[model samples]
Target: MQRIHNVTQLADLDDDAMARCYAYPRQLDRPWVRANFVSSIDGAFTVDGVSAGLGTDADHRVFVLLRELAEVIVVGAGTARAEDYGGAHPDPARRRAHFQRGIGGSADGAPPPIAVVTASARLDPAARLFTDAEVAPLIITTAHADPDRVAALQEAGAQVEVAGAAAIMPAAVLRVLAERGWQRVLCEGGPHLFGQLAEADLVDELCLSTVPKLVGGAGGRISLSASGFDTPMSRKQLVLAEDGTVLARWARR
Candidate 1:
């Protein structure tokens, strides 16, 4: 890792090195909410209708590290479907080191689970997110969500939990995650979910990777919302990879 002012932040990206880079918060009152995203230099979060275009080896490396440190990866259903998110296939060495190194406060030793937030529970029953899950993909919904669809998801192998009444509330989502004993919440977003977190003032950190490319067209930016805020941020780390992928870490201020 390198500092924004050309100072050497770190010398390597080895296991120990990366682990230290993404170490979870030392102390917490509640779950620490963090989000990860990749974007183009033009401020586009998605290209060709997805976020895959704005990715690089370095960004992916950091992505894995963040997941390794998190105890529960919270994501919007739309992003999960778009990214083809299956169960976490954690690296054996990485998973082992995470426990041994004590990344976050887990009740017992286990890789983080994926908790997907959705209103309709329309995810496919056979989707790898469920069938091939390492940990059963948790389905978060509202009481007012379609009950029939909820039953379908429950039959589909998801542990459905009602977190709200009509619309999915951020606080309710956090309550469900905490009930599962997760203290580190990693949110991989698709705008809607991110906006909700922002609206509720729940975002603690953001890991953004800037790919060195220009994708000029109609595409989603990092944020899309009816509710927006001029939130202040503190730069925690700024590293320029050899491939010019600028990986930045910021804390909400």
Candidate 2:
């Protein structure tokens, strides 16, 4: 992993450091999209593992702002399981801002839908995700998943669908999103999902939040592994944003 001391070192930053961090790629006009994540100096996505504890006051503000801009939030099942994700409900102030922009509904309305990608259909419905968030959940699965299991989630009111024959393919997921008229999709990942997306050439941009501290553990890293391409599949540049966070944008060739 690359390390930098401060946010100013990034070359592409704009006046509102937050806006620059979430800027979309020019090539990604619709359907496909990207967002990045990073941690704070403590080497925690949270104080433990949740995202809520990773940022400064400014960082948290920008984090919510990014969610407001996205039409859907895509996350791997492991992340959903670990984080106990409920939905992509932005704060009331941010929701109002989205309403002004005609993206979200009134305060009483539901938040943006969440797309959960999983290889197996069997997951704990009692997991904090379903019980906590108000928005309905969308499950993307493979044909390998059990039909009865899918039915259970459906009975519980989730919208479940098969996206690939064996494992969920990034391309098929994007196609499904396009069909639903979801143009801006934000992917919050565990390393495995990030590796799959990067290898499949599905990601358009990244909003990495590079924290200052490091934990030399065998488990955590920005990516699981590099792609097996004979040549480079893409290139990225970093931009320094608020509170020692670095946003890295990668465009796939």
The TM-score leader among the candidates is 1
Could you give candidate 1's per-residue lDDT for residues 1-253 as a string of tens digits? 7525622233356767767777887666698899998999999998877887788988888887787778889989998888887877656566667766667524344567889998877778778887777777899988877788888788878899987776788888998998887878999897889888977888898889999998899886776667657889988877778888888888997
What TM value does model 1 have?
Answer: 0.91
Candidate 1 — which residues are off by over 4 angstroms?
Answer: 1-11, 105-109
TM agreement with the true structure for every prediction: 0.91, 0.75
What's the distance in Å from true for residue 10, model 2?
A: 12
- Per-residue lDDT of candidate 2, residues 93-164 (tens digit): 655555554543234434668888888976677666676667778899999998888887787778887998
Runs in model 2 deviating more than 4 A are: 1-29, 39-54, 92-110, 225-227, 230-243, 248-253
lDDT of 2 at 133: 64
Q: Which residue pairs clash in candidate 1?
A: none
